[model samples]
Target: MSLSAFLSARYGRGFRDRAQIEAHHARAFALFRQRVMPRSPFYRDLAQVPLAALPRMSKARLMENFSAINTCGIRYDQALDVALRAEESRDFSPMIGKVAVGLSTGTSGQRGLFLSTPRERALWAAIMLGRFWPSLARRQRVAFFMRADNALYRRLSNPLVRFQFFDMLTPWQDHLSRLEALDPTVVIAPARILGQLALAGPRIAPQRLISVAETLLPEDRAAITAAFGVPVDEVYQATEGVLAMTCRAGSLHLNEGWLRVERDVIDPATGAFCPIIHDFTRESLPILNYRLDDVLVPDPAPCPCGCASLRIARIEGREDDMLWWPGRAGLRLVPADAIRTMIACLPLRLRDWRAIQRGNVLEIWLDGAEGDAERPLRDALADLGRRLDCTPPELRLHAGLPPEPDAKRRRVRVLPA
Candidate 1:
């Protein structure tokens, strides 16, 4: 599927002209407004305000009124039941089928259920193929890192594409074993996990590497590409759906055809935003003008890749992952990625560390050799604390930091449970 052909089929002739993207967006928004207003009482009431007068709906508001948001007959409680059942059965196709329901992994304490129509799913699949592998016409094997395999994967009929699911919940060693056997052409996993794999060295050589389901740290990106000898692309997908993806040039481009992303700037000091997203692809549960807590900065300049869609320089990690440490006045939340960045600058002697917040104290655990290992790590931690204007908390040393059951290693965690 060539980009031009895919866009023409999906958006008609207007897609070729750059100005028509906004025009297409306006048309899709109007159609979404009409379909959702009558079928979904939740959206009807919320969207009652004039299109020009509608206030931004925040994440808190969406969660509060989740049940009423869906146009489908299924209530919020019912959707939860259906989603859980589908996940447990590992046969999500029947529950989703022509409908698209992707459950949030719930790492941030709030799990969300997103619903999309068959048209949306097809469009999504087409866009993904068009963006990622437009050059490949022959059959290509893809190793997908997913928590649960869904029917959507089973039903995809592209003779040139074969997808193999690699469960994220399994141990890394086990997944590596499976990857060795599959010998897939493409590898996709979370950025942190991909970094770990790179550190372990490559057992399989894949032509393409993709990171999804989490933010891709700058350090991780370099490591993955160096290990695989291939440029690593990022798919900015979440429980909400596929939001954006990187082009061949490694620039992040918005999925403009399916969703309208309105960016809200964060205070440089606070680093928080209320993102308003209008999901044109969602009809079963219309997420019209829905606000997200995730923070992002829209790129002002055109991408070097020459894609017409909007670009984002970075997709900062989740809001909940922000670190809160005690100060003289009270507790303060700081961007956790900053700590990770600082640690990346230090020598490789300090292999891994995890931050845990308990009461007024933040504990930093260092996992590496004993002598002088703690010194550089502690200095780096203190420097980060000083830069963030917060006093450094307790620092400790450990033989090893246990991995989360889900196979994700958290750089920052809330403690005192």
Candidate 2:
């Protein structure tokens, strides 16, 4: 079944244009309405309504209406209980009957309960393994680093695959020996963790390194690639589902075959938009017109892979984290990439850097920065502000790096004072 799901996802959709993708969505949604929507008490009545007419769903809204939304008749409170219990015990084996219940990491304001049936889990594992599998002849060892384990991911373990889960709560330094001992052929972790592992110089030379959960920055990719002698690949997945993955050409492409993506543009200049997704592949929970807070910058240039799916240039941080500087006409967004470029051009060789905006203040932290490095950075930012027709945030320069977060590592952030 896993192999069949893999073959279908990898080769079934020979989508070559926008029309083909839309036609696919039409057929998928038709089947979904006929087979899946009637099962869901919440969506049963709204089955006939146009997709655009459906209410936009957020994490909070979904959790609030969880009992009615799911086809499995799982109550919100009951599901949360199961999810929380597994989180506390660190044993993800428990499930609400045949459905796997897991809690989202809650980066998007509220924690969410995600459900997957046996089939859903199989399809997920198949797509991942089929697309990113290094080789089929050899039994591959996979070291998966995650904040919490879910039975959904456990499906990847079979006779041909050795799957090892590393709990993120454990000290990373302590895992080094076990990691070296395992000698995994594929190492998967959050981007920052992968970057640190690259620097740690572990003996394991993985053929493939996949970055998940967190945004992969330019520096992180460069370091990981240099150390491992393999280009860093990415899997942009959320509790929502697998949204996108890196193609063989090393470009990030949306999984348009499994879902329909609608863009809500936030930064027109950069073509940066928050994605509104309708995933027909999810039967346990129907995710229609689900608006994610993540900002994605689209690449207009065509990918060499010729898949014709939308290629993503980068995943900008959350909408809340987008830096908005005061301008004469209105608030102007300061792209995180711009800040990185400004710092990169600086005379000082920075070991590390972080930019944080709070109200009218921008705090800049630099490792290996001396007092002399401040003036040049300040000048560069001022120049940028002028170019953007905005007032530069009051600069607060610090000489040392900020303490890294235990969860996802965001190099740049914006928040209230």
Candidate 3:
């Protein structure tokens, strides 16, 4: 579908002009307010304030009122039951058309259930296709990587487009074999996984590469782009949903039609956001002004891509992921991304490293390197301390790094005494 036609259908033709986007927002917001206030008893009660007077909603508040927020005819308990059954049966789309329900594979402690309407799904697909492959012809194959096989992949099919799913949990050799067989034009996967694939060097080739799920670390980005011989498009998607995607110029662009994001900049010391979200596409569950637990920094400049949609720099890990360090005043929480950046900056030989915090002491575990590595790693850790305004505590180096049981690896671990 043409962008103009899509915009007209969603926000009316008047909104096609850049000047009328706000009017479109206003109209959409009004409809959202009306729908949620009456239909969603959960939101109505939690959002005691009138729709006009309601401030941005928070994650905590949404969880607290989880039962009352769903506008879909299904009850919360019923939906949960349906979701669990669907998940077990491998029929993930059981509740899709009636009420778009999808399970969040929560790497973070809390697993969430997200819902949307078929209309929202269609809009999401259209915006995604328009933004990501504006110039591509109808016939193209896209290879997607995720931990589990999903029924949602079927929703992306069209007569001209084909999508192949690659399971990340499967062995790397298996993926390589599948990729050789598929020969997809486009490839999408997490940055770390793609970096691992890049280590093989050049057997896999695609016209375009897209990174999603995790923050694309600079070193990994450089390596993958070099290996693939194509600029890597980083997509800012999370369990919450497909938040945003990068344009041709590599600027992260918000999916304005699917959702609206309000960023909360938290002081690392206090692991909480000020809280704010104005989700317009949430009908099954009213996500009005929810506070996301994740930390993010809003982009300071408008994207050169010409879309007015607001964008954010990579999500710098969740609040709980921050490592605690001993400080003169008290214990201070340091963002894990800071440590990751420090490690990335170091010129040390290492396969993988994990930072573990126990009370006042910090432990650094190294996987592929040994004894002589202390100097550079220590210097990097010391530099991180300086940047975070905390003293460099004793760093204990482990001979080997241990893996976490979960499929999702924890780069930083906080251990209890």
Candidate 4:
């Protein structure tokens, strides 16, 4: 499909009402099922199967079944070798023929390799430009900060758009001067780096600031907006596919226009759900009924922008971030959102922080303001304890926290098995 024509038809729908969104999504889902079920061996036998009856796919399952899981016939071992070499050499142009090959940090402990056809890459770029670009007609200088790179991300560069990839492994301080020099019209980075950039003043102004890869914590968003004087929009994407993004009104709306999401409820009361995503846009690696570990909370109210796609209230860190401790009867769990809420409710501006649960002990790291950290810290702990209905874990405030292992930083890490 022609990029311009695809964008016009896919995004021009305006998604004015819920009915329209549903109609668009249904058509997309139906087309995807019909196309993928026949072509992909992973899904061939299930052609006549209902989606709900299909076994859910996960990162582990995908990796184990990698060869069969992909319609592209690319071997997992070969792809991993290529992706790793690219990362090591800092040259991402190499691909499995015309396909785009990229590696994920393996946020869940196992590295993931993703493949995309040339057509898929173009579609992704077009979709990104269509959804996130400040305007279609106007030229844009986009600075994308990511740990790795691929031809897919670079494909958008042209006379109309200047796309630059800032490697996260490189010294960030060195890039500050270049950042000021580039004067990017749009800046995209993980939430942590975005916060860091915001904190590193004589601030550079950008028409648009987008947070990707990491959860856009409320505190981080507030800080970015305060520093940049621009609304910090977010793109909710993963190795799975481009799942969701912020609409014009700045609410995070699921990209239900091109993907269908099945909510696996973790907590109905909190509106927290683990999504089973079926991405119609991904042909190389069709992600049908694929389950992810991340947790998302849906907003009940309709967006002011009138985007009928499922709107998200917040992206809770991860399902694994939930802490558990032994109680009289059994192990009691403290929801990840509860811990996040406690810290967010505190009066301090959390510069950088991490919460790690090691058995019955909770290790808290804070790197903000010098004054006494105990009072507000204690209050937050009290709230956490009250909510969990158990004595809070031994809270120890450490002076320094460990550096992040990858581009994706988890504010909350659960260490105990």
- Candidate No. with top TM-score: 2
Kindly list the per-residue Cα lDDT of model 1 for residues 289-348, writing each as its tens digit. Answer: 666666665665776666678777776555555566666666655666676776667676
Which window of 10 residues has the lowest lDDT sum in candidate 4? 5-14
Scanning candidate 3 in windows of ten residues, the lowest lDDT window is 8-17
Residues forming the 10-long window of minimal summed lDDT in candidate 1: 8-17
- TM per candidate comes to 0.82, 0.96, 0.83, 0.91
Separate clash counts for every candidate = 0, 0, 5, 0
Model 3 per-residue lDDT at 62: 54
lDDT of 3 by residue, 1-417 (tens): 345534432333122333555666667777776666678865565444644346545444554556777776665566668778866775555764456566565565554666767665666566556545523555777788876544444455567668887767567777877777777777777777788778976366677788877777666778888888888887776545666767555777666655655556566433334335566765667666566666665565766655666556555565666666767667666766678877767666678788877766788887787447788878888887777677876888786777673555567766764
List lDDT for all candidates, in order: 0.67, 0.88, 0.65, 0.80
Of 1 and 2, the candidate ranking higher by lDDT: 2
Error of 1 at 295 (Å): 2.8
Cα displacement (angstroms), candidate 3, residue 407, comes to 3.5
lDDT of 1 at 36: 65
Off by over 4 Å in 1: 1-24, 45-67, 153-157, 170-178, 199-203, 269-274, 297-301, 307-310, 324-334, 385-399, 402-408, 414-417
Return the candidate ranking by TM-score, descending: 2, 4, 3, 1
Per-residue C-alpha lDDT of model 4 across residues 167-216, encoded as one tens digit per residue: 98899788888888878889989998888898887447798898988888
Better of 1 and 4 by TM-score: 4
Q: lDDT-based ranking, best first?
A: 2, 4, 1, 3
Q: How much does each candidate deviate from the true structure in C-alpha RMSD?
A: 4.2, 1.6, 4.3, 2.7
In terms of lDDT, the best-performing candidate is 2
Backbone clash pairs for candidate 1 read none
